[model samples]
Target: MAPVTNGRVLFNAIPEDYPVPGKTVVYDTTETIDFENVPLNGGILIKVLLLSLDPYMRGRLRAPEIESYMPAFPLGEPLTGGGIGVVLRSENDAVKAGTHVRGWLAHQQYYIAPNLSMLEVIDRDSKLDWSVYIGAAGMPGETAFAGWREYSEAKKGEVAFITTGAGPVGSMVIQIAKQDGVKVIASAGSEEKVKFMREIGADVVFNYKTTDVREVLKKEGPIDIYWDNVGGDTLDAAMEFAAKHSRFIECGQISGYNQGYQPMKNPGLIFAKCMHFHGFLLAVLRPKHSAAFQAEVVPKLVSGEYKFTEDISHGLDKVGDVLLAIQKGTNKGKAIVRVADE
Candidate 1:
């Protein structure tokens, strides 16, 4: 037997304000990953096939000393996020060799996930593409699902507004709301993305980059529900036009992901209009939606009734660039790293 080595992307330095590829992310060509040293308890060794890069992972790149809802990526260690893989070996009876799985697997070719509780085996008969588990059918799908089901509980026929509507989560949010009979007005960064939003059933899609989002929302909506993805100025504008007794799901603030959290200047809208606002993250919501998502959402995904977009770049070496591109909104839909072929 030969000594095995795994390539991985490590979190090198915590950014002061923004992440620089060479400075914040370091790619190691020959990181040692001893295959013989398997998980001691009910664990599994995952052969990572596809990895999803979502904006939430950016928040996890903080210094070790800081504490937040999610643990920060430690310096000089492999970065971990939601990804799809196949089990190569397992001490856990729940998972077996060749089982397709999804979990917080590291940015590596092979990883021993010591905690089986954190990993989930994909449904064998679901007929979804492997990358879908990490993209539309996975966390991003669940995030959009949970946000609407929980926070933005707008009834059918309501006018819904979604920010960053072309991104994975927001795009799903747009579709889900449409399915529920809501008339959706969504915002995207580019014309291509705006077209994508309309293609996915958004009633009106505006290019927030060129259009006055505030003016458009005012003209198109006295919005009943607002699902915000990029918070900053867009949120401020949404607040002005939010309908009385409306619901606001604060799903993400990607604009502030690299710049650090920014304060909402027009928060007084909550009190003035008697509106409801909820700060949301899908981490906890995932478990609650996992069963329903598989039962309800997976079928639609497989049937092509519901569509998803993913920008997949190949190889372990491209992880840093892929992530940076996602943060920059250069990639459309869900950003995935195709580490291996199915």
Candidate 2:
């Protein structure tokens, strides 16, 4: 067979603020690969079907010298993240052709999986949509599940405040808390998102763009649990209304991801309120909680008992745009980009 086009999203340059498509990240369509001639080298050739566009990816667009939990994106290379794909050819005995896989995958239509340690073969008989493996049933969903179980010491009838409640992590957090009989007060950036949050079981939902977060919290909250997703000011206000010994699950801070660092206004509240402010890493928690999460949530997802929303964009060109939307809090749900059809 002749060489086929291999489109990819490349990290072109580091950004000071929000990454700009075409400049900071580029959708390059110049590359190609011959299916017949490409060497397997004890690896497998995969056709990527879905790629997750997440808020945390913004942290990866940095100078290589600076270190974090994850490495910076090397310039002039494709971005990589949680993805779902099908193996088209395999030289490795453990991986067979025509099987679906979920793991760290490149931001391209085609990829070569040289290391199989990180890859997990998905069940083909499940009959689930490929997007589910990259969105609702994926990293973002697991992050919410593991984070809540590890941090939230929630009590029945307690008030819980969740910022970014319509998002993948926040949406799941809202439902999980409600199931445990916790009253939830959550916020979103748009009216549509606010409505979605309410439908998913938030006792009180508001548009942060049109309403004041502090005012809403004052009226309905003396929060016992704070599921924090955005950190700058909303976090401060949640602290103001926090019940003594409140548990704070410090997740991603999308608010500060694109801007210069802004210190919290009253961090001393941590001591005064005796708040258990804990930040978590998904990588550390995933291995411990993955099986439990699948057992508990997968059936619910299949039965439509667990509700979710996916803000998906199609094509490799949409990666940068969707990622930018995630940083700005404009996306309605778990941001994803579809690269190919199964």
Candidate 3:
């Protein structure tokens, strides 16, 4: 067993109004590594290996009233999100020591978790990389599946458009949609990402920053589904090209995140086309579809029917920089912080 010591917990205490220079992360030390003695009963102690840096985390740093999905990160405490870790110790029969699991964990090297009902034990012999659990095989993978199935109801031979096409979830969505005989039109911020999108099965890929999104969509013809990731102007442009009775899956609004918030410029387009715009959160699908997703998608992942990409950053100290990079569209695929070596 690794020697226990006071663990460091990192948090962004003050929300940044705009891009701030230098270390924005604040660190604190905890006395006990064991939460078994805490008032919350049957908790486990986790030695974290990987932590996910996602766009949704940006919303968490803001005031709670501004967003209804998740609570704001409180002052003087560690922020939590999806992570993969090993159970160092456990007070629950379901969770045993040394078991590999993934769930929401604080941004720290080690922490005593009180309740982890969302946690799942990872299969070590699954023939897939463990990091994929936090990427393709994990929430992002599940999100793509659920979002497509629920929002799009995508059928064979339909045309699907996914924004932020080269990222983990967008790439997976493109692959899955293509396999179903759906033609995919994907948009990215850069030419490299646009090229990567085509490499990953996008029927038509365009760099929104460089190319005319509406013109490209016009050339592609009427799209049946739009899996939106980068919202704002991109979403507005996509709306102009959406087919009648088309489904618009609002996955993430990454474009407006840095601006604090931006008003939708083309709300009228949705009504004119009678397009169905469904906003999705992955957590909502967990209760009803977790079993099906695991049974159907997990096995296929092992056989390589589904693929994922990751932009791994070494060390826990670089968490802030990595997150900023993701926001700035610098990191490729899913941005993951490797907290400890396997």
Candidate 4:
């Protein structure tokens, strides 16, 4: 084993102003670990290949007092999130060198983990691409499955509506629902996204920005399940059209992240419809249902029963721009930063 230097980007604070760009600074540091000196409990070094830039990362950029499921990234440290990397040198037999793995960790060129239990060994025999591990086969895919299965309890032949249909998680929800014989009604921000939704098997897709959601959903008939990724007006409109005993999975609220906070305007619809509105966090699901998810959902993805779209940005330096683009709803699919190639 040889000495190696790693470069990483650190997030310092949250932006106070709307459309205020978040700050990231890249710096280099050296590692001191050799095969002979590797700690008994220490895992070896890894070189990150792909990093996920999700809407949740915005929440982490805020201060700790915000008190979300995930704590805020501390100032003067590398920001952490879900990522795919290849093990370079490992003292732990469970995570051998040369294996590609996905884990929750700091955003960096390389990481040194002391037997991080959060890291999982990716099956190299699988035909899925490495990027899929960070996208459909990884956290986003699991989030979609857990949210739908545990919260919505969706059934066949029912109508499922998803906001932000063009996004990675939303798109997968549409496909999974359709595969299970559920009819899907989806809403995206643009015409191109509407078309993309249809291409991915959304039964009916609408441009929410231009079209009236209440009108479009009404024409599509009753919505039995509503996966609300966009909050505020889109959520309000979805509630209005929901059928009796409808299931609403509140996975995210990207619509209000930039605008600070907006009051909910349609509380009456929930009562009228008897809708089951539930909020979901993926980190929580990991402990509660990870085994079931790996057994049930991972196979579907590996077998091609589920499809995914990647909205990848090249280079680590562009991570700030990619996060900004995703927040603005510019990225078409799962926004990822390609740090290196496997």
> Per-residue lDDT of 47-104 in model 1, one digit per residue for the tens?
8999888777888889767888788998899999888898888888888888888878
Model 2 clash pairs are none
Candidate 1 shows a clash count of 0
Candidate 3 on 1-342: residue-level lDDT in tens?
344554454555555653232345654554444434433357887889999888877776665567567887775567688999998788878888889989888888876677667687877445987788888888888898888877778888888889888888898888878878998998888877887888878889888878888898889968889998888877777788889889989899887777855677778878788889899798887677678778877877788767667899887767777767777888888899888986
Q: Which candidate is the best by TM-score?
A: 2
- In angstroms, the error of model 3 at 37 is 9.4
CA lDDT of every candidate: 0.84, 0.88, 0.79, 0.79
The backbone clash count of each candidate, in order, is 0, 0, 0, 1
Global CA lDDT of candidate 1, please? 0.84
List, residue by residue over 241-327, the lDDT tens digit for candidate 4: 779999889898887777665667888878887878899788777677678877877787788777677888777776777877888
Superposition error at 222 for model 1 (Å): 0.9
Q: Which candidate, 2 or 3, has the higher TM-score?
A: 2
Off by over 4 Å in 1: 33-42, 124-127
- Looking at candidate 2, the ten consecutive residues that score lowest on lDDT are 124-133
TM-scores, in order shown? 0.94, 0.97, 0.91, 0.89
Q: Write the per-residue lDDT of candidate 2 for residues 114-188, one digit (tens) a residue.
A: 968778898732645778777668787898889988889878999999989999889888988888899999999
For every candidate in turn, the CA RMSD to the true structure comes to: 1.8, 1.3, 2.6, 2.8
Ranking by TM-score: 2, 1, 3, 4
